[model samples]
Target: MIYLQLFIVFFQIGLFSIGGGLAAIPLIQEQIVDTHAWLSISEFTDLITIAQMTPGPIAINSATFIGIRLAGFAGAVVATLAFITPSVILVMTLAYIYNRHKQLDAVQALLNSLKPAIVAFIASAGISILQTALVDTSQLPGAPFDYVALVLFILAFICLRKTKFDPILIMLSTGLVGGMIYLIL
Candidate 1:
């Protein structure tokens, strides 16, 4: 029963999450954390961090993690297959349609219209992650904000926007710095 539910939930996510893996974060959060009550917000945030740090798409990584947490190895397989199935079908269909109508004005217009919506989805995911990453005001009484995380975020943003450094290198460096800081403090 739980496996069935996981399949349906991830199937929906894969079907409707239009802008790739990162864009699926908001939907996955809603379903896994809010709807199913499977994982807490902090757990979801940590899942995202792990997903981002590893190979492959964030959506697949998240599905595997959540499934394992819920029901172990078999659950992970089911969830991953469910998450990818819709994308496989959709991509094949879209590829055929796109190839056939590459020069059609309507096709071009439809593609253009989708770009903004994709951007919106990505932005929504970013905001959701941001809320989790930053200090939660409703935390313990008089708890201080996560200044270190904030500083790292700011530096990362600047590095991404201003420099030509590779993002993976930046992430690794920040992870090292963050770990050291936590150890020292």
Candidate 2:
């Protein structure tokens, strides 16, 4: 039953996560965190961090992590396969159609129309994660904000926007600083 549920959930995530892995974050959060209650918000945030730091697509990474956490290796296999199956099928089909229709204005227009929605999905995911990182919502009216997180976020944003430094370097530097701060205090 759990395997079946995992398949169905990840399959749906893959099928509708049209803008790629970043776009899948909200859907993953909805189904895994809100619907299944398999993980708390903090766990989901950590999952996102680990997923981003790893090599694969975020959605696939998330599927593997959640599946293994819930049901071990076999569950990881089922969830990962289910999450990618739709993308494989869709990409193959779409490649054929796109090649055939590459010159059509309607096709170009359709592609252009999707850009805004994709931006929205990415922004929504960013804001959700930023909120989680910056504030402890569980404490409600008097929750203390994470000033250190805010400072790191601003510095990272500036570095990305204004400098040619590799993003991985920025992340590693910030992670090191943040870890030290937390360890010391």
Candidate 3:
């Protein structure tokens, strides 16, 4: 029953969450924090840090970690399958439709319209996560926002906006700095 429940819940999340992993954070936060009671916000925060540091997409890493935590190896397998099913279906279906509709301007235009909406959704998710991470509201006093975090966030943004270097390096450096700051302060 737990396995089935895990699959259904994650399937719903994966099916509805558009614009990829960071965009999925809001939903992940809701389910993990509010619905299941499997993990706290702090746990989710730690899970995210682990997910980002390892290989593969953030969403997949999270599914595996949280799933296993919830129900062991079976849970991990269940969550991973559930999480990816929707995307696999979507991409395959869209590819078929796109090939058939390639000659149609209206079909292309619709995709273009969706692009902006996806960007907006992703931006909203990023802001929500940032607020949770960088804010020191009364709700989560223990995880107060550190000054080092703010500095790194700004510096990384500057580097990204100015330099042509690969983004992964910047993320790794920031993650390391964040870990050090989190531990020391």
Worst 10-residue lDDT window, candidate 3: 138-147
**Model 3 C-alpha lDDT per residue in residues 56-175, reported as the tens digit of each score:** 999888999989999999999999999999999989999999999888999989989999999999999999877765776766647566567678888999999999878999999999
lDDT of all predictions, in order shown? Answer: 0.92, 0.94, 0.88
Residue-level error in angstroms, candidate 1, position 14: 0.5
lDDT-better candidate, 1 vs 2 = 2
Superior candidate under TM-score, 2 versus 3: 2
* Model 2 misplacement above 4 A: 1-87
Tens digit of per-residue lDDT, candidate 2, span 1-185:
99999999999999999888999999999999999998999999998999999998888999999899889999999999999999899889999999999899999999999999999999999999999999999999988999999999999999999999999999999999999999997
- Measured with C-alpha atoms, the lDDT of residue 157 in candidate 1 is 90
- Which one wins by TM-score: 1 or 3? 3
TM-score of each: 0.53, 0.56, 0.54
Rank ordering of all candidates by lDDT, starting from the highest: 2, 1, 3
Q: In candidate 2, how many clashes are counted?
A: 0
Candidate structures ordered by TM-score, highest first = 2, 3, 1
Candidate RMSDs in order: 9.0, 8.7, 9.1
Model 2: lowest-lDDT 10 consecutive positions: 56-65
Q: lDDT at 34 for candidate 3?
A: 92
